[model samples]
Every structure is written in structure tokens, then in C-alpha cells.
Target chain A: MSGCDQCALAGVLPPAPTADPGRPRLIAIVGPPNSGKSTLFNRLTGLRQKVANYPGVTVEKRLGRARLEDGHEVALVDLPGIYSLSPRSEDEQVAHDVLAGTMPDFPRPDAVLLILDSTNLGRHLMLAAPILALGLPTMIVLNMADDLRKRGGEVDAESLTKQLGAPVVLASAAQDQGLEPVWRFLTECGAAPSPVDLPALQDVPRCHAWAARLGRHAAYQPPAPPIWTRRLDSILLHALWGPVIFCLVVVVVFQSIFSWARPLMNGVQWLIAWSGAWVGSLVPNTWARSLLVDGVWTGVGSVLVFLPQILLLFLFIGILEDSGYLARAALIADRTMARVGLQGKSFIPLLSAYACAVPAVLATRTIENQRDRIATILVAPFMTCAARLPVYTLIIAAFLPERPVLGPLLGTRAAAMLGLYALGFLAAFATARVLKSSILKSERTPFVLEMPPYRRPTLASLGLRLLDRAKIFLRRAGTVILAMAVVLWIVAHLPLSAGKVPPIERSLAGTLGRTVEPVIRPLGFNWKIGVGLITSLAAREVIVGTLGTIYGMEPDAKSRGLQAALRSDLTPGGAVALLVFFAFAMQCMSTIAVVRRETGSWKWPLVQFSYMTTLAWCGAFLANRIVTALA
Target chain B: MQANVIRRRAPASLAELRKGEQGILDRLDLPEDVSRRLMELGFVPGSPVVAALSAPGGDPRVFRVDGSEIALRHDTAVRLKLRPAASAAAN
Candidate 1:
């Protein structure tokens, strides 16, 4: 393996993937939770990383090509952070599997970079015993060297290296300091190192004793944790002030997404319309021109218009998560969750579900209890995701006015949006209570969460996350929504009478919509609304795009905005029912597929879909009945 | 399920410790796997534990062990048996 030096010197030759035949030398980046592993991975790999899932599982597989200074390109995988090799949850199971070279598609690591936070070496050292036992060439990268130094913590790296029989490097990955040793280790440790005596992690008590003794022999002094965390916790986790502060945070996040993103969303909408007009002007107004302007532009643009709102949502969510505040919120929400038979850990996933259910379902991997995880996964889609924002915003803006209900702080529109969000949250809780008490019953798992020290989230990291999220959003708009739009346009114009387009009611798409209309008409939806619901099954946001394409094909609808076009066609009662339906319905195929893969069967997703759709039907019917009566 | 723990002997557990109080962890009176996890997190026997601020309803409380704050709910924390130490650490 050390012959990579010759491979490098073969002058402009591609670094041999000699280690794994086709794959580069695989090095697993292992760490304890919040051990600055990601910070280090990001620094080393920069943006060369590809984020994907392990084959058939929702667990993320983050692989990146890290160019060693010696011109050797190695593949670095960021394994799920775990306390030990003994698996406790699916996340730990995957990490353990990958490290053991049992995980499919991921080859055995030729070497390992074990990252442990330097400031908390006493406890973090427990990971070393299991990782070291694997007998791979390893480097103990003690991350957060700066924090340890600033807090007057001390560790004898020479003594530590001697005790652990592994090279130890003190590094502050964020500050780009003490990293030369890391580069040297990568090149130098190409050959397997001498195996050291290691305690099996399965004997947890013995393992801890071994780590504790090693720490003492190394003279590892745990850093003084920041004083401000306790001080802040006194107020932030206050009996009275905490809940109030949490509510205030949610409101502020909600209000800002609307007010801050309005101008941006409008800018996007204007750009989309301008481009459509520009493209339309150049080409003669034929069916091909219509396909480009009305079909592709309208369909994709309608979905694309919500990108600003989605970005803003992630911006706020990323801030909360990275700043360590979300951990506190989990603690706060635990009490509320308990009534529904879940713990605080479930709250984090449920909260993340508000952004999107896919990752939120993935997040349930942290929950140790199987029943609790299933319950959380099932209720995830009920937390109104960013995709639903397009539909909610369009309807609420058109139906509800801009007048403030709670003075200038809360507009009628924002209040209406909040009401819809609350509606989804309530439905989630009610469903969870039923599921927990009925079939998915289990004892409440121990809630043990490490409260990470609060740090100001860096803009570079936040910006990177936002960019990643934007890519996902735009990719969906380009692919699914674009294909659906084009297909819908063709269907709406089918059975061309005398080589001419027929009215929408006589077209294939319209006939299909009309067929489904009777079933949904009880909820006050027309055939167009029926069409939107049918397409929304692809993704929650596709309804907005479907409507955009549908109206774009109509002559009168072409003259006005989407919301304006919607208002003329839908009654206030129908609008409320549409909102309620989306709030409870499982509209995303991706989420269902993930549920299937995660549960390892279609049974749970089938039950979840049936249950949620039934709930949606009932809730939408009630809303329609009430709203129409009131109107 | 430990009968001795259910008998409620006099020794205080983490669930009973007040803010600013300190204790030494004796043994984890929990299921083997749960206790194993607790030990791995530096809650091993003879280690120091300092009480920290808790949540709003005070069910899940933060305890400082090995220079880190960990929030454990009463259901689990109550099972952490304590061996009283000589001096209480000043908060």
C-alpha cells in the first residue's frame, strides 16, 4: 500500500486505485457525536464531497476525495458519530457495519482517522478502545486543540501516543491549525501499523475502565467547560421563561421567512414571468412555443418561485441546529412529547420534519426504541414541510388579507399560516397518541442527550448547507416538476380536433380529473383541483406546478397571477379544504419510498398512507362543511 | 428491575440531587445495556457528578460529568445509584 509514492512519481499518472481495484484507498473518518468530525471533514475535503444514502437504507453515506499533499487521492467517508462499536441504534449499526467492512458498496477502510474532541478526552477516549481493536492503521486526531488550550486544559501527546500505541495529533480543524501532523499521518500510515492491545467495546464497563486508565496515564486534563452554558441554561431552560422563549423563537422564524422572503420570492416570480414573455416574443405563438413557455416555464417556474421561501426555511433551521439551540428545544419539547408517548429525542426529528420528512425520518435513527422510531416516522409528514409552503402561501395570501391580527407583529396572513401549521402539529400529536397506545406501544426509552457547548454557527458552513439545500430544491424543479408539467400540458391538449387543441374538459387529462372530481367534490374541489391533488402525489409542491401548467393552458388564466387565477376558480370553502387535505395527506412519493426502505417493507407505508389519507378526507370534509356554512 | 432500588433505601440517586449538589456515581441500577452506555459516557463508578440546570418541567435534568453536560430524564436518572462524596462542589 505504501507504493503510492511510486504511483505519484509515475509523472502525471492517475493515482492508482490499487488499494481496492477500482475504488481509491478508503479511509473511514470516525468520531463521537459533535466531536468536530464534520468540521474536520469539510476542511480536508472542502466541497469535493458527495452526500448520498447507503444502498437501500436512509443512513447517509458521505464520501469525498481528499487529495493528500503527496498527490495520492484517498476516499474519506464520514461515518455516523457513535460512542462505541457496539450498536445501539440504526445509525450506530451502520457506522459499526462500515467500520467493520461489512456494509455493502463501501469497501474496508485501508486506514482510519479517529477524531475525538480534545476538550472532553476523558469520556471521548472510550471510542478509541473499540476503534483501535479493529487493528487498522489509525491516527488519533485530537480535534478542538484550540478550545482545550484556551480553557487551560493539558494533555501530554507523547505520553498519550505511548499509552494508546497510536500517533496523536492536536488539531483545531475549524481554525486550520495543528493539521500538518494529519497530512503526515495519511502518507506515512499507508502500511498497516503494529496492532495494540485493545479492550472489546462489548464489555462496556471494562472498556471505560481501560479508557479512564489510559487518560490518567497520558495526564489528560479535561478542559473547563465554558461557564456561560450553565448561565444561559438557567434562563433558556427556565421553568417559565424557557417555554415562552421557545414559542418566541418559533414565531420569529415563521414571521421572518414570510416577510424576509417576500421581496425575494416576488423577484423570482418577476424573473420567471419576464423570461416567459421574452421567450414567447422570440418564437411564433405556435404549439411548440406554447410547450416551451406555457408548459415548461410555468410548471417549473411555479415550483422554482418557492425556492426563496425554502432557502429561508433552511437558513433558520440551520441556524437553530448549528448554534446548539435545537438541542435545548428538544429538551423543552420532551414534556409535550411524553404525553404522546415519545421522548425529547423524537422531538428533534419531528421538528426537522417541518423542513422535510425524508431527512426527518432518517433522523429517527437516533431513537433507540423501535416502536418510538416507527411512530415518529409515521407522523413526520404531518409537520408541514417547506414544499407545502407554496400551496399554503398562494391560498392564504389570496383568501386572507394582510391586516394584522396581533398588531403589526402578526398579520392575518401569517396568523393563518401559523394556524395551518398548528393544525398539522395537532393532527400529528393526536395520531401519535393513538398509535403509541394501540399497536406501536413501548416503554419510554431513556432520554440521554449530550448538550453541546453553544458556539456561533459559522457563515461558511451555513452558506454551504444552504447551497446544498438549494441544489436539491432546484434539481427537483428541473426533474420531477418539469416532466410532470410537460406531460400534463400534452395530456390537456390531446385528441386535437381537426389538428387543433380541444377545450380542457374534452382532453384526456381533464377527463381523468373529472373522473376523480366526484370522489373529491364532497370536499368542494373542482376537476382542476382534483388534477392538482393527483399530481401532488409525486411531491407536495407539484400541486402548485400542476395548477400553474393547467391555468397556463387556459386563455383567461394567462392574463393574471396564479393566486388570482386560483381565486376565480376556487371557493373559500374549497380553499380551506385543500389546505386541510395537504396538511394531513401523504403527498410525497419519495417519503413513502423512504418509509418502505426504512421499515424494510411496504406494510407500514401502506398503513401510513391509508391512515393519513383517511384522516385528510375526514378533516377536509369537516373543514369544507364548516367553512361553507360560515360563508 | 432491582428489588433493592424499588425498596427505596436511603442512598440518594441523580434524580434526587439538587442543583449545585455533588455526588459520586456508585453503580448503575439499570438494565445492562443502558448502564453500559452510561458508563461509556464517563458515568463510570467512582466518577464525580455535579448537578446542572434542568428543563422547564424538570423531568430531564442536566448533570455535569467528566466536564460535559448531559441531559437525562428522571426515568433514567433515578436509576443512577450514588455514593455520597465528602465535599459538595461549589456551583
Candidate 2:
């Protein structure tokens, strides 16, 4: 089409609809891992995509609107990267279902965009062959074409297109080259041809041979590895140096999360306090004033202060994942993971659990084995997620002295924080071992992970990822945490009496706390702490907010900060016990709901909750006794 | 069959090969699902392979096969029978 004709067509179309009017023509993007499918999707859709879980499963699918040159819009889906059509993992199953037209929620695609890594064309086509045989109009994009050319490799796209009977485009997604050809092909390619003649899916060996034959027919030749890549792999994948470097990287990341985010956290806290004060002065009525300042501000502000730390944590994680170090880390961790009867692939999800169990549990879909996936999901919450950071920081700042443990290098508080994280990991490991030998016992699956070549992560992609994470966290705060805060405020303010007694002690939460007091007495918690613990079931971070509201509402405590109030009321032993209780407790309702949804049963979540609660109480009691004895 | 057996000694498992050693994959003595996955990752019979690197414990090692690096546990590696490459055998 001529440029003028295209412009005319674009102008003739009605104003673009805000949302898809009907079932828009579907175009699915499918590819193997590290083929730059996601990069291509990002280029095609920009910020117009929405990410949501598929119906009934926790696999995330990205849907966006792609406008053709004729101004006709089609729905573009970015499917999770998978190796082949044979469904081994949940993610692969989702991709397979959508292709087979079996997923009730998703329509069969009008075309398939099969992206292949030009540098590893042979293996990538093994996945492409099955997709092409499904009879959909397919366009093969040779991503990483620049990297191929730099290594003295050449691909004749014309010959490959003729051989496969599909349109082929050579593009470097990372360098942003050769995108116009893709759009042109999508706009011009109208009707899908009938399914190509292909050998039946008999066995793995047969599939490999077929793919190898296709590679030769297409004249696919992988480029020589760059000298620097070889040299770096020698050290990074070495037996002796690999684990050491990995441990050093982990240490640096954790230290950065603590030290780098401190200033930002303090600023957020200051802003919250300032706003609360400003709003407090405007509303003079005692009840409304207290509800606004003491209830909402103290409750929600405590959780909002943790946003900086969570962002920092995800930032480092994004770098590690994007730079391709996470795969190597998983390979190195496979040995230790095997000892616990888990596979190497479980490493990333479990490590991510340290950020938050909700996403970590969702990430378990990558594990192929059902038993292993469930095992990973079960023990994920044991890791100290970001929710516990607020509680740990509060307790450590209030109770633990900031004396240097390593003579200006590390402080006692830092050591305690690290120890808590280590404790979480140890508990998860032990739990995995026990569960493996008993209820979830199964044969060990082979660990075959593809280690992608490392590339410097682009700023735009990393910024987008960090922004996405921030959005999810803020959305949760806005909905679940905000609702819980309002409900908690009402609960802590009910049964108003005419006397001078504090409303918190006479409120519904007070009664509930007293009811659980006898059970928690041995753990060194009073009714107020018990109230915080009970409200924490909504979320672990809510404990901080709950305590803030409780202490904020007490008589003569309005001017004093929550931290100061906690220090005067709580003993050191009690603080340590509370911290230990929170460290192992399954206090996140969202985590529980995710587990139930993922496992397709409440049986597992109930079992998980009970066991974790038992462990938390026992650990808290021991911590209290030991600290009290030592003091 | 007897003459063919006498032409060469038994093949060595990948786990027994030291670093930098080369071998041709013979067969995998593993479960069907596991062996199938291994083959899909370019560990088919007659594929040339080299021991690339190992972890600290010397259990899970990275093996270079068909221009790609794969990490396998020692136990899994032992299940893959391989014939030592001619150059390595000659050396």
C-alpha cells in the first residue's frame, strides 16, 4: 500500500474505541524463553497493555491493542514463554490451551507471532514447528539478528520464508531495529493457509530430529560465541568461584535494600506525619479528628512507609533476572536444593518469596512437577517478605541497641535483621524436607534449565518493571489495606461509654484481644499486643498500623510517636517474642487465598496455616523465655 | 554382535569424566520423562559433549552439548552413558 493510501485509510476509520468493541481479531505472540518475545510485545504495545491472570489459573497474560496500518485494531496477547506445545508446566498448559482453542475465556488467535532467537535457531524452531502445524497464519521473527551478525552469522530470511511457507522478519528487539517489516507483514498477511504437512508427535527423539532437519533446510548457522562471553562464563559458572560470587551478590543486594532505602523511607514517614498534622488541625471535632489522624493516618501510613524498601528489593531482583544471573544462581543452588528434595527451578520463586509470598506463590507455575510446585508454594510464606520489614524495623529500632557489631562495619540491629532473614530461610528448608519425606513425597524430576546469554538490561525495561511492581503494591494498599484500616478503626472505636476510659480498651478489638490473652500470655504479649497480632491476620504489615492506632488512641499519647509508646510499654523480651512470632506466622490473608486458589483446594491452605501457626507460637514462646532468662 | 563388543571397551558415564573431557552420548538410564527432557535439550545419543564446570560441592556441573551449556546433578549425569571422544582416549 502507498503511504497516502495508508494515511487515508487511517483517517477514514472512526475514532479509535477506548476498549475492544467485540471479540477483536486475536493475535498471539508465542516463543521460547530468551527469544525477546516480551521485548517485542513491549515495542508493539508500549504502555497500552494490561496484565492479568488467566481464568482459573494464576498464569499472567498480557493483552493489548495493536492498530494495523488500515486503522483496524486487533487484540494482541503475549503468552508466557514456553519450550514446546507439550504441556509440562502450568504456563505451558495455558499457552497450549489458547492455541488449541480450548480456553473458554480466550478466542482462537487469527495469527501467531512466533519469535525465535536467531543465535539459537535450531532449538527455538523445535517449539515453532508445533505452533506452525496448528494451521494458524504465522509470522516468524528472527530476534537478536544484530547479535547474530556481530558474530559473523548470517540468516537468509527469504529462503527461510519460502521453505517454511511463512513470512520471516529479521529484527533485533533489544536494539530496536527492523520493526516496520513486522507491522507491514501483520497488515498485509490476510488469510491463514491450511496446516502444513508435519510428522506426528510421536516421541522426543523424533521431534528433535524433525527440528534439526528444519534447521538445515532453513540454513540456520549459530554465530561463534564472543570471547568476552566465554571468559565471563568460565568464572561465573565455575565450581569453586560460582557459589562464592553468588553469595557475595546476595549480600550486596540485601545490604543495599537496608542502607540505600533508609533516606527515602524517612522522607515518606515525614510526609505522612506532616499531612496527618495538617489534616488533624483542619477538622476540630474530636471524633472525626481522631478517626482521621489516629485511625486512617496511623494505620495506612505505617504500611505506606514500606513502599521504598519494596521498590528497592524489586529493583535489584529485576536487574538480576534481566541480566540473566538468576538462572546461573539457580544452577548453582540446584545442588543444595536437591538435598531438600526440590529442584533448581524452585530457587527463584523461593528467593522471590523474600519480597512477598503473593507473587512468589503465583511464580510457582514455572515448576513443571505438580508435587514440587505445591511444595514450593507451601513453604514460600516462611521467607521474610517485605511485610515483615516494617515490623522488624520497628522492633529493632525500639528494642535493640545500635551498637556496632563489627566495629563500624555492621551494627547489632543489622545483624538481628539478617538473622531474622536467615531464620526464615532455615525454617523453609526444614519444612520442605519434612514435607517431602511425608505427605508430598514424589520422585525427583530432572533439572534442565536454559542459561540465557547475559545482556545489559535497558533502562526503559527496568523502569517499566519497577513501575509495575509499584503499581501492584499501591493497588493493594489502596484496596485491601485501606478497607482493613477502616474496618479496624471502627472495631477499635466501638462501645463508646460516657466515662474517661480509653476507647481502645473498651472497643470490640479490646474484647477480642482479651479473649486470646490467655493463649498468648506465655509468649509475653499483653492484650494490646494481642490485638495487634489478631489484626495482623489481615496482613503482617498491618500489625504496625494496628499498633500505631492502638497506641495513638491512648490518653496522653497523642503527642508521642508510636515508636516511643512501644518502647515504654513493651519490654525487650516482649519485642523479641513479637518479632519472632511475626517471622513465622502465616499472617497474610492474601497469601492464604492465593494458595487456596493455586492448589484448587482449601485442604492444603488450612494445613499450611495450622502448621505455621503452631511453629510461630512455639518459636515465640522459646524466644520470650530465652530473652527473659538472659536479661 | 560379539565382534562389535570386542572392538571397544564399555562407555563411561558423564559423571565419571573429568573437567574439559569430551564424550559422545550413548544412552540415558533415567525415567522416561526425565530422559525425554534431556534429549530435547540436545543430550541425544551420539551428541558430542564436554564437562564445562561444577558447583562447589562437585555435584551439579555445567556440561556443554551441541553449543549450549546445561547444568545436571551428579546423579543425573551418571545416568547418561557416554563413549569417550577419540582425542581424549588417545591422550
Interface DockQ of each model: 0.58, 0.46
Per-model chain A TM: 0.83, 0.84
Shift of residue A376 alpha carbon in model 2, Å: 3.9
- Pairs that collide in candidate 1 are none
lDDT of 2 at B64: 80
Model 1: number of clashes?
0
Report the error of model 1 at residue A604, Å. Answer: 6.0
- On DockQ, the leading prediction is 1
Q: Model 2 misses residue A177 by how many Å? A: 1.9
True interface contacts reproduced, per candidate = 0.82, 0.49
Query: What TM-scores do the predictions have?
Result: 0.84, 0.84
For every model shown, the clashing-pair count is 0, 1
RMSD of 1: 6.9
Off by over 4 Å in 1: A1-22, A281-284, A345-377, A383-422, A438-444, A521-529, A536-579, A588-607, A621-631, B1-11, B84-91
**Global lDDT of each candidate:** 0.79, 0.78
